[model samples]
Target: MKNYPQAARILVAIDCIIFGFDGKEIKLLLIKRNFEPEKGKWSLMGGFVNEDEDLSDGAARILYNLTGLKNIYVEQLETFGKARRDPGERTVSVVFSALIKIDAHDSEAVRSHNASWIALDARPKLIFDHEEMVARAIEHLKYNAALHPIGFELLPERFTIPQLQKLYEAIYNIPIDRRNFSRKLLSTGLLIDTGDKNNNGATKKATLYKLDTEKYKANFHSFWNFMPDSMKE
Candidate 1:
């Protein structure tokens, strides 16, 4: 192998900002660093990219290692390459943002990795520039949610209209009118009647619905003007 002798050495790291929805509020998956400069501090799930490994592959590997999940929605969020970002080394990090259903991940893997699903609003301080990475990921999530079928990725296979409304309220951190919200979602025709009710079997249980995934894929980029009046800037 040939190398540039005059070039400086640099390390590459992949960090995952994994978000989940637990039928209430948004949550972040964080791990307690078991080694290094800040061993006990909360941190995003991350790992160093291996020799000959692709960046996306490294991100996927890191996420799966922590959550025992695969084939989930993952997108490259940003690159953080500020000098001395990692006190232990001169490293550049590529970040990936993932949204997973809270009930679908492996509980054992999370416990083994010392990872916990912390509510976004109540998360603790994180190591390095991971806090900034999380803020940026939230921005991207908000942006994408306005133009994409975000619930399809984070919510369960079947959920009530109120559940969907609660998700939007959590993401935007604002109150939304329930009547208008339900009306708007039904107008989109993106939701399909599942002919089922909430599992608890409440007498007045809300009907459950699922995304019309086929229609979504047919016009994947067509979800527009989806934000409620309060959600818009």
Candidate 2:
């Protein structure tokens, strides 16, 4: 009657689909393969689960190791267990997606493993079931965008209203009504106008706004028209 007799065998792995928005296009962080099975190809940052670590901890460790990013907003995505998913071994990958501000981390380390931020619209062929993982991650992002306030995580601290609108449009892949979008966003009172205008390449200067972090974090669950009729459950 030993506890070891009741132990279960489970294979777990962490795959990170890091999403970044660079003002115009939505991009995904991909790392080129350095080992066999798919050497010299693009893939998501991932690693095997450790013996004494939780799934999230393993994911954070993998991300930290690859890009020196920490405390990012990581969420569990899906579990891929197709028999032929891995050619080297029979394993289950627990995928995680994170939204990181492009300017938050050092870019040099990220570029070391041939890492590059490829625009989602122009992504190359990916290895294993990673393409599927990225698709699911985008869907999750869309769904979450309609409900949660996670979109701000992908933007810089100080951003223009147009930039914010562009981020939303990029995530949804649909053009939002400019006037209505701006009105609704301003009505939320989550943004603090810095009273500063950006003079970078525009005839008319745009006012810069930053997320009132304390206010946002405190009242993130406030009522809003986030979810559409389809997502209502």
The best candidate in terms of lDDT: 1
Per-model TM values vs. the true structure: 0.95, 0.90
At residue 71, candidate 1 shows an lDDT of 88
lDDT string, candidate 1, 1-233, tens digits? 25788888899999999999987789999999899979999999998999999998998898888888898999998999999899998999999999999899989999999999999999999999999999999999998887877766888888888888888888988898989888888888889998988866332389999989898778768865568787565
The stretch of ten residues in a row with the least summed lDDT in candidate 1 is: 196-205
Clashes of each: 0, 0
Report, for every candidate in turn, its global Cα lDDT versus the true structure. Answer: 0.88, 0.84
For model 2, how does the per-residue alpha-carbon lDDT over 1-233 read when each residue is reduced to its tens digit?
27688865556778999999988889998988999889998999888998899999999988887668899888898899997798877779999998888888768878776789999999999999999999999989887887667878888888888888788888877777778778877877789989999887441389989998997788776665543333344
Query: Tell me, what's the RMSD of every candidate?
Result: 1.7, 3.0
Q: Model 2: runs farther than 4 Å from truth?
A: 1-10, 202-204, 226-233
